[model samples]
Target: MQVLFITGQNQYGVVSHFLDGMREDLESVGVRTDSLSVESEQHIHRDLPQLLPLQEYDQLISFNGMGLHLEQAELSVPQYLKQRPVWVFCVDHPMHILKRIIGLNVILLCVDEEHVSFAQLCGFNARLFPHAIGKQQLANTSMMPLEDKSNEVVFPVSYMDSGSHRQALTPYWSQIGHWVEQSRSVTRFMQFIGVLPIGNRPASLTLNEQILRLCVTVDSYLRAKQREACLHFFAQQNVNLTVIGRNSHCYQSIAPTHQYLNAMDFTDLQQKIAAARYVVHNSPGFERGLHERVIYPLALGTLVLTFETPYVNQTFPQVCLDAKQSSGQISDKEYQQRRKQAHQQIEQQHCWHHQLRKLFTSPTTSPDSNGRTR
Candidate 1:
């Protein structure tokens, strides 16, 4: 099958990672897969989108709702549905009113069985496509080996606003300060692995192309800024925050309460996590509490504590501890046990490559699948 997958290009978080992996898996399995979005030309992207009318294409798949543009693509929801080939949406939040309001007939790349059932009740065709990861990055990573279990923590930041003048994390920073001062619970959690800093080499564009280039929409940029506030909130905590790569300006701008450090290389990251007491993930208080810092920390066998939100329950129930319920009260021995349990989960079900294979393989024709067809 010829499949065209469209999603936004900005590497703000995990969407690019998952969507790109899907295309790679489909191609390896001998299906023709094309991955496209506003940032399709970037190095991270394997497939590309073009200006030609998608109506001429064999199949079109929107990643959530990637290709729908007001003027540039000249494709509206009505036109999109009327010419629909195979429309599949990948969304993890609670049921959206749009499924009922717009009256769409598209299938969904749902997160779980509950999500599928809920979508069905709301009057849409949905299917469970469990959360997964891609294998390509597995080969690319330096693959850090575990360190001697120490009381360290990892605090990762998302993107930030360079244009804005005000510091965003003021309210939450005081709380983190209080926790750091009062909580001996995470003595080992004191060592933090902060975010990967952006190397920020803007992609080149020609004059006509410059005008044609799609900048991040205002709403998307605001969302990124909001994530910055989430990260900054943890700045004054007692832990030692070691940054992975060149992080955003919000982190770079502020003086850290905890000492700051940088990685010598990617392998060093593994050593840092293995040694840390626990992982303190920064999650924005938003409609859905989504943060990647939580998931990767667990997969690496670190004990994770994050903001309580619906997304965590939907995306990563088996691997993570509910941060809201956790008082940060566990002993060092208890912490180690949590780490041991977490790594076991990763080995069994959360390896990125393993999940990628599961996601891209379309619903099989096997009779064991009860002869169900999409």
Candidate 2:
């Protein structure tokens, strides 16, 4: 079977790399693949008819919901999309783009299990599909002896302060904050938001749509808070730390002494991760999913020090640690063994070749049975 990847420009610049890796992996497994670049929503209206001949491709896959704005596109565009299976590989929380996806004939391949539940709640078809390590990540670095790797810790993260968002949602801060603090998991947070009353919602949006917008705002705020707290905790430890990614300088107040480098491309970031002894990661509101940030380092033979999430605690208990719990030192022998095990696990289950094969072979539900249509 052949698949067409619907791609577009994104701020993070990692989507293209992900598509490239997925295409290569799929091809290796004998699944033909191609790509369609839709620069914007207008392109979907103007270019899709002549460019996208659905018969040639058995399926269409989009990263982060790119080129799937059926709500805004011309009727013909959505009509074409409905003719075949369309799958969106959501790399972020589904709440962020739920409005655009509602009433569309598309399946959501979510990176987190909680995301799946959230989509299902909205009457959409969603699957739990975690991010996979690319071949480039593995090829960029070899497993060095634990003692030979530098003692430095590398954190590849983008810093965003949520102060403004909190201020903007001042009236709902108390309720939102309580939900964030009291909710044990993402699913619980969703349940809390579902009951929240937003009287000031615009007439153009339905209650559920307004609630989803609030959820996105609150989720971003919580992630910023968590990242700041993690950075402060690391600062107190006085270990050699390097922060890489966009807006690294914004972390000055939290981690003044730590080295900061501007964001680099994926390959360069992988090289930095490979040279480090440990990679520190903060989940962006994922309670039951592994981010590529957490997976790539492990695949490159570097130990990951991340917040204690359910998925991580269960899958990589050896590397899971919360702010209250110390990361604690590991002996070289133990470190090497952990790295070996992590690498083996990634190769077996978290590689693109394995994930794509499973996805393509799996049975899909009919759109009529999955959810409502526009």
Candidates in order, TM-scores: namely 0.50, 0.84
State model 1's lDDT: 0.46
Q: Once model 1 is optimally superposed onto the true structure by TM-score, how far is the C-alpha of residue 292 displaced, in angstroms?
A: 3.3
Which candidate has the highest TM-score of all?
A: 2
| Candidate 1 structure quality by residue, lDDT tens digits, 256-326 | 45444543333455456646656665433232333345545665556665543456655556445554555
Query: lDDT per model, in order?
Result: 0.46, 0.72
Worst 10 residues of 2 by lDDT: 365-374
lDDT of 2: 0.72
Where's the lowest-lDDT run of ten residues in candidate 1? 188-197
Candidate number with greatest lDDT? 2
> What's every prediction's RMSD, in angstroms?
13.3, 5.1
